[model samples]
Target: MKEGNVISERFLLNNERALRLFNGYAKDLPIIDYHNHLPPQEIAENKQFVNLTEIWLKGDHYKWRGMRTLGVDENLITGTASDKEKFMAWAEVVPSTIRNPLFHWTHMELKNPFGVNSFLNKDSAMSVYKHCNELLSQDEFSTQGLLNHYKVKMVGTTDDPCDDLKWHQQLLDSSFTAKVKPSFRPDKALMIEKTQQFKQYVQALSEVSGIQIKDIESLVAALKSRVEFFAAHGCSISDHGLAALPYSYVLTDAEKREFESFLKTDGSVYSNPDAFAGYILTELSKLYHEKGWVQQFHLGAIRNNNLGMFAKLGADAGYDSIGDYKHAERMSAFFGNLSLTDQLTKTIIYNLNPADNEVFAAMTGNFADGRMKGKMQFGSGWWFLDQKDGIEKQLNTLSNLGMVSNFVGMLTDSRSFLSYSRHEYFRRILCNLFGTEMENGQLPDDEEWMGKIISDICYYNAEAYFNLK
Candidate 1:
């Protein structure tokens, strides 16, 4: 019925300097999506989507959360609804997402690559659906093609310690342009709280590593072996998802024997689970340092709040929320353990709670050895905080408390191929922030210096941080 492009060329940048920096430098930089849930299979096989909804709506918890907020039915949001019906349901919700970053992100995704700049409302649903579906059928819209179009230089997919990385291996062997590598995520290995899952996971680990995990000692050996295996396949990153950093409480010899006994058998957990977690994490961090891997820790998520939904749909299906965890002391202790031993590697810490922005930022400064360019990074806003207000707050806080110029920039953390436009969304906001400060005379009017700063934050910093050529 009507047509418009909400995310214009100068949409986010409020000042002339911001606009010039974004256009001249940040826009064309190669994307190093250092952390995401993008399926390696999709990239290796170059999977083609049958329709727009398959790529846009299918399995995107971000959109699901929005639609469910407005009382959209489960069937329409994630159930067995027709593709057109789900697109229309999302169309109904898109216009209502005003002031939400999703509104800008959705429109930007539509505008770029797909060439559909009109607002995605109920009226334009059919037209936009047809246009996007047509493009999805082409070779250019397949997984690899989308990576090529976006200039994605490297992608680090979150992976378990036991993962065979068959898809990653396939990509490495193929003539594919993108460097698809795996980042070791050993969250489950550290999850000693879940008895059943932990036991079954140990079995899987034994199967993969051929090392029968009889106790905590064996578990460490198995994980170390996997780290070597991953490094062989070009893994330069490792990630941990913890509620907060675990501390090392001193243990007596008797208690230590008890803990080891429990580890080999199904009994009450170690008396000092926190200390155990800290010890294992420290050991792993040492290995990471030895291998020169960048270690990432995502903290402060109080997940599965909605028990009914959690039981029905499981985790990361939009049931997680921010937690108010007191992380500074334990975080410091954890880092202190590594740094004191001279075993601290390049580390990025992502806090989900915006309230803890300054806390996390300040923590990064505590361990800056000047050895690594940005030795300790306050990571980009993630999960619950991956929005405009949150992104700006994190950036501003990092600038105030640490070196924002050395920041590694944004990531999708998304399960969708259409989410690369988020990089554009972030770069614009970044330039706007820098340019606004210049306009207010808070910073010197230096476009060349400012442009270089913006460009490095967007691309060069990430390339150097991740050691990507």
Candidate 2:
């Protein structure tokens, strides 16, 4: 393989059939990134990055964490360092990230958009930076241009209920080809443990929804109003990030009263955090079902572990890690309750901890709706589990427990425009997995038939699942 072709044309494809499936079925398929953290405003404005660091290093906690691991100075990582200096610091850590996904991601990103086939390292940092910076200065390197270059058909950006979605509206009127929509993410609304923060969030929610949130009923009403508002703005999906699925079907009336009391006071402690979260999430899920929206739960992440670094850098600063939690019961209770009521809409569950793979996969089977093709989806490998082994494990598990043919495929779940290479990464892995099966005769030695399945998992399934025609 060439220097920058580290993830070559046949990087993960091991056989001739694998290569054929990748090139013929998956390579040029349009991307519909159904969930991600990319900023809608950047796409609306078509913002041009000034340098390599600004585009690649900024807000990328994956690189920041790697830099910190190398004992790189805080100043160079996220402090008041020059952009070039930060790029150099990142390049210094690139070679050290040999077995890490960042290593593959870095070179693939360079090779695709910027056409830099040289490997990135401290020795080659200056030339790579200068070359990439020149490319960044081009109009084709702007935000919208990058999305277009990657053949992105649609992107669903994570957004708060309090947002006006003005950027999404702006994109609607613009000539941008790809559809940019919002996914309602009201995680903070469920955080009653953070009293002041919750209060402030509720107040903002009230202001936006034009409804006073004095109690649980009013709070739900306000959230419902926002849901309707979001629906008007072309949002048909809701996302939640939680350490575990919170569920409590037997909370005492006194506990509910305590929640009401806590809401009215600036109390130092809220003892009913679990019940409150469960109650609010249930109500929200009902609203999601009513709206015919897909509800996504991203579970098992213990976030902001290092308080000192958290205080210094804040949330999503690379301090989060996989968490262990008993998920089966709560997941069953939550979905089973909705299922019983005939209120379970299309749903996708993403597990951060790979240990819960079987649990999540089996649980999706328990609530499968016969009406919808892939209603209960065990989503693609996410966060800490989006790499080769993770992807293969998820696919194998889903295939064992359910129909792999109906599986909705890869999502960037990323915060960068250049991360579209991840889709390429995922496609190559998918083709390799199926094609290798064909080679071994475990599956039929058929290209066209298997190619359809590969293309479906890569693109067609998601298009149908999300109703993104």
The 0-to-1 C-alpha lDDT of every candidate, in the order given, reads 0.88, 0.89
List where candidate 2 sits over 4 angstroms from the true fold.
1-5, 250-252
Q: lDDT winner among the candidates?
A: 2
Question: Worst ten-residue run, lDDT, model 1?
Answer: 247-256
lDDT of 2 by residue, 436-463 (tens): 9999998899899999999998899989
Candidate 2 differs from the real structure by a C-alpha RMSD in angstroms, to one decimal, of 1.6
* TM-scores of all predicted structures: 0.97, 0.97
Clashes found in each candidate (C-alpha, N, C closer than 3 A) = 0, 0
How do the residues 9-120 of candidate 1 rate in per-residue lDDT, one tens digit apiece?
7898887988988899899999999999999999999999999999998889888999999889999987889988999999988989998877988999998888877888
How well does candidate 1 match the true structure in TM-score terms? 0.97
